[model samples]
Target: MIAPADHLTPDALERAQRHLVAKAIAEFAHERLISPERRDDGGWRLTVPLGDAEYLFDAVRAELDHWIVDEDSIRRLVRGTATDLDAQQLILELQPQLGLSDELLPLYLEEIASTLAGSMFKIAQGGPTADALADADADFQTVEAAMTEGHPGFVANNGRIGFGVSDHAAFAPEAGRPFRLVWTAARRSSSHLALGAGIDEEQLLSGELSAAERDRFATRLRDLGEDPADFHLLPVHPWQWENRVAITFAPDLARRDLVLIGESEDEYRAQQSVRTMFNTSHPHRHYVKTALAVQNMGFLRGLSPAYMRVTPAINDWVAELAAGDDTLRDAGFRVLRERASIGYTGDVYHRTAEPSAHRKMLAALWRESPVPLVSGSQRLATLASLLHRDGEGRSVVGALVRASGIPAAEWVRSALRAYLRPVVHCLLAHDLAFMPHGENLILILDEHVPTGVFMKDIGEEVALLSARTLPEDVRRIVSPVDDEEKALAIFTDVFDGVLRHLAGILHVDGVLPEIEFWRLVAETVDEHAAEHPHLDSLVDLRADSFAHSCLNRLQLRNTLRMVDLADQSSSLMYAGRLENPIGRARIPQPAARETVGG
Candidate 1:
């Protein structure tokens, strides 16, 4: 006879059987869907269906297979009234076909029977209740008895379900709500309990818990017979659990807000420094300005005293401009007066001599000056000095007339009248030859007393003839040849070297109009060549052109480099003086000779 219902009561055993049944059904359905077969005619076939139809059929098949005995085995086990054990044995015999062996037969049968009974109970009572079947009570009791035979520590809460642990105090919640019970079952002396929904895992793991709280939670979990490691909880917002845990526990997360609010004073200052450095002409100027501004703003910003010492150098051409050099001054003034006397005010007269009255006026200013006047040679030696000085450094009308270089005294007066009318015209028109500084030697002549006009500079004349107007081969040749060669050499040297140097110092990159600066230098040498054609013939004009071209390129490159250096130094000064004290001190010192030359 089958075992009576009075024999079963364990909940744990019942739950375990039910779990196994669900798993087995899932496995069976999966295998059926994947299994390949052959028909009697030797045609290959797979019974798997597509979509919802496949799932429905597979689930139904799995249920039937779990509950009913196969046709072949029914006769052996059903002699008279079949006992539960006899039924089980018959089920065991079919186990191998189902991929289950003798050792697994008991567990497999129990699981299948539990699932079927539970489903039937749920369906018969209502639609789909979670309540267990009343008919399976005896079966559950039998399974519980059998489970206890293999293990003594087990406790049954109900049916065939069970659990065991060393202690019951380990089920405490670290934070948030207590764990909610999902299911319960029992088998003999053991019980199984599944719980979910509790504290967040992040909150539990965060090291903010105090010593007492940590120990208390640990002890309580042990009492409840659960492993703390096995349970995972959700994380809680930091603000939600304040005093429960220290804020420092999550250093990375905690710093996010603080970092957002923190000021970047150092970075702000650095950017300002960089802006100031680039803004000024010289980097140091920016620094000095910044320092002064900072002090005015009541800050103790540092500034170097050496930066304050770079002033414009005194001009050295002042003495030559004085009337005390009377002969030279008179000659310059005479030339100006002759130009004024002529009707040549604008751009007419190309050649001339210096005048007197203009020279004396300029010379008087230079003689009284404490500092030397700054000027190019064209302005200083020829125009300023010649207008003012005489042979004994005394002014005289006769001497001025003679020095004007005209054969007749009347011509000097005419030139002066011609020259005076053009000063305003030249200044307004930017005429290259009739320039404001008298770099051009234009003379205008009139019928009577000549008005002294633009005074030409003798130094510029010398530079033009000597340095800028020399032939290339003459320039390349070593000094002190024959008189003719000497003259060519001197012209080349002065025109190429001295005049060009002055041009560079004055930043006269494109000032002259009649000739290119270097071409003017070549032309000066050519002028002297008329006296000695042989010396001129010795020069290779083609070679000289190429050489001057190279020199021009070199000079241009050097000028650009100097400009860049000036810009960079200005930037550095603005940023601040050198950090190193000794280096800062040395910044004002003259640059090393090699570096300056390079």
Candidate 2:
């Protein structure tokens, strides 16, 4: 029950505030949601609603309308007196301007506070500088841990909204605390377990839980007057069990429908996405993502029971496609499938409540870890890590590029093969769209040079945009969508959502000029278009431009009431169209090579 006081030092707190204030200014301005007047001194002034209060900061409105705001140069002026930045005060003052309704005001403020606190926790640890992280020579977790920023565009990215100070210390991913998960036995009648091809419960349990752990769990089940054979076993994040499951689903526990089976023998560490835990005890084992039901960003961060039914099938379908397609195989595109899953649906919640409300409270899925699949000396890092700046402001990607011993332009072509090629091909050939976000995509690098990509977290995120003909088993991946919106999955999700920030960071890091970066992207797209002429019927690159969907605006608009998100394309908020970066780029042809990675 100890608080994370050590991580929340005054210096760290102040640094967190300054960092987040910079984010608020950058994101709001970039989204074109706020109007800031340019000043003659090269500083921009954002006036407060209904008053004389103002915020002034030096920033370059760069490409894609990115606000490259300088953190140290930001200040607030009230009645002609200047003061240091305060994130909470800034958000409060801009609440009306942000269009944050009264209903979402208080919770939004709490998220901002939690985000700042999490940032401070990361800062207080005198971790490796960005230069060191760029080296890419550290342990896997060390490199992952060194990522200072959470979501690039999200101002309230680290909002672990459910955690108390004590919970934060014990369970926050940045804490790097390794602990055993509390296992459980849920009656088969009350839960659903889905397994992919050639796998069963015993196979999964044998790999994840040792014989001794299984026996111990069985004993706990027997002690509750139940046979282990009649129940399915699942691991629960200890903190989640204590804070949410124990209290929220007390009826099931008391009725002996869900029996506690003590801690597992294996240890796990949380990934940056708090609900998902990587099996540090066995690196090659499945990564278990559990439903914690914490409200973060805009809505409850819970895995849906509805999705669990088709989870394994969806992954299997996609994995088979990736393996069968010569293009996907040639590009070395891999999907770390969610091979198995178990979800609980309580009668109380099933009949009385919305599935999203309570049926989503308890669920877990096993996604194959990339460690075992990694070939040669190839290492895996989340795509987000590219933008990761260490304490000393060194980028992870910059270090990787430097280590490759190749020119920035050459290295970018290599990177394009690994990252962008697959995405464009996936949409054109397979009629599929992976979330394509940094958190969802893991980058595959060999000797710190781009090789290929291994994607995970598939069930809910990957969707079939054009389901011309799908196998009966794989039909679960299809989401109801129109042609125009389906195309945005590529445009908005991959290009603007991820590559915009990546290009900016690489430009800032001297890896590749932003123009050249987009040029590479455009070339990759054009190459894919040339390769897959038949898929021209499925998609069109000739559409003059695409919608610049507003991600922050979706959260702000839905903060009060989240739209029932049936599909990624269904509930969208587009600010306006920024001209396609790809269209503007003068495409470049690679020197003749056997592979794009060369």
Candidate 3:
């Protein structure tokens, strides 16, 4: 048995705390929740206005006002004396400036410690060095499990609030353990199953389970004096079954409305998004994403049965859109459709709970895997891998660039063309936008060079801004945003949330300069605009600046539900304005190349 406290030594905890503190300082400062004054030694100093605590660090400001802090240079001082770098203490000292309410202070501190603990766990694991991960032999799932950073913008990105240390060791993505899922059979009357354009129950099940496995489940139901035909089978996270379902749904289990089935024969590894699991036993099989009641990031990570009802239809529509578009097809952009879903609704909670986590506990969806999409010598890596920095502080992207045997600028241009151009076209032509952050994208690489991208998380994150007509079942994706905020679908989500960090990584690693990075991005957008000049006015990419949508502020304001799914625009929190790097690159500067190269 693995000891949970083995990684909790003072050295590991201190290192993790320092790394998290650096991230908090950088992200909080970017969100304008804290101000760090520049010191004469080319460093930065942040002092609490209401307390005697102060912090000193060195960081370089990059595009979109990103703070590339040197984690080793961070130091904390209180009353003219040095103090241990504590992430929880940092939050407490900055509570007044953070605008955290009296009720939220304690919970926020807990999240901070949880994040720090996760960091400590990763440090203890010491899975792989950056160069080792970038080697040609590193497989797809290996990179996925080896990821250290959860999300680029969020400080408490790994706060799995409900998970104990043992649960963390078994289920967390960083744990990299393959485990089987618990299957349960819910009465057909109380459950719903939805399939995509060309899927059926038998066909989905045949691919998911072998004939013997299905027979085992059916025989188990028969032995319990229940007919298999009267129920639907759903796979659930093992932790949720032991902790939540067995205790909360005891009456349903007693009444035989929900029968406990056997575990899956195939094993799956957890993705960075904790609830989703990739089938390692059969790599070509569909990915299973189950409803996890655990609290992570800002909200309870639950899958609503209502959303499951329409998820496949929404995915089918998006798939059709991608297939029909010429530019998207030529760029080799693909959408991993949520082909099928099964949701179980327990009668007691469905009637009493008012659209909270209780109503969303027992649902799961199957997404397409990128394994079967590649052929020949092609390779697959999560887009998040490009942003990964190993324990030795070497970036995987730098290793990838070296392996590609291409100049850094040219390689970056290829990546932008493969990833960014398609996203731009989707927005300008169809007024369609998605949460295209790194974790949601799968990059198809040709020996370390990105040639295409596969976008997942379709049904949940897609936002359709056009007045285009849609099927009744697919209307759940028709999210209406204000005309002014429409551009933010690209600016805020892509540039600030994704590319800003990519640029910083490359710049910090000494691979590509920041100015050249944004210039290439602007060039890609310009080329797309030139092709369809009429659509250029739809999303004005040449704007001077855009609203600084603060992600950390959303969580700070309310950790329960950061944004309403039905109306996401209303919950946006903004600081001042962020100077658009693309707009800055568009200006006529003949000497800009010389400056970056020099």
Cα-based TM-score, every candidate: 0.15, 0.94, 0.97
Worst 10 residues of 2 by lDDT: 584-593
lDDT of 2 by residue, 91-160 (tens): 7788887888878778778888889888888887667765565554656676665666777888887777
Cα deviation in Å at residue 320, candidate 3? 0.7
RMSD of each: 49.7, 3.2, 3.7
Compose the digit string of candidate 1's lDDT tens values, residues 417-508: 23322321121121111122322332221221243333332111111112222333122111222322222222222222223222221122
lDDT of 3 by residue, 1-598 (tens): 6555788889999889888999999999999898899999989999976668789989999878799888899888888898889888888888888888889888888888888888889999997878877887788888998999899999988888999999999999999999999999999999999999888999999999999999999999999888999999888999889988888788888898888989999999999999999999999999999988888888898899999999999999999999999999999999999999988886588887366688788899999998998898888889999899999889999999999899999899999999999998998888899999989999998978899999999999998986667899988778766655888988999999989999999997889999899989888987887677576445677788899999999988887678887788889999999998877444542222334556
- Per-model tally of clashing residue pairs: 144, 0, 0
Tell me the spans in candidate 1 whose CA falls farther than 4 Å from its real position. 1-87, 103-212, 215-598
Choose the strongest candidate by TM-score: 3
Report model 2's TM-score to 2 decimal places. Answer: 0.94
The per-model lDDT (C-alpha) reads: 0.22, 0.79, 0.89
Candidate 1 similarity to native, TM-score: 0.15
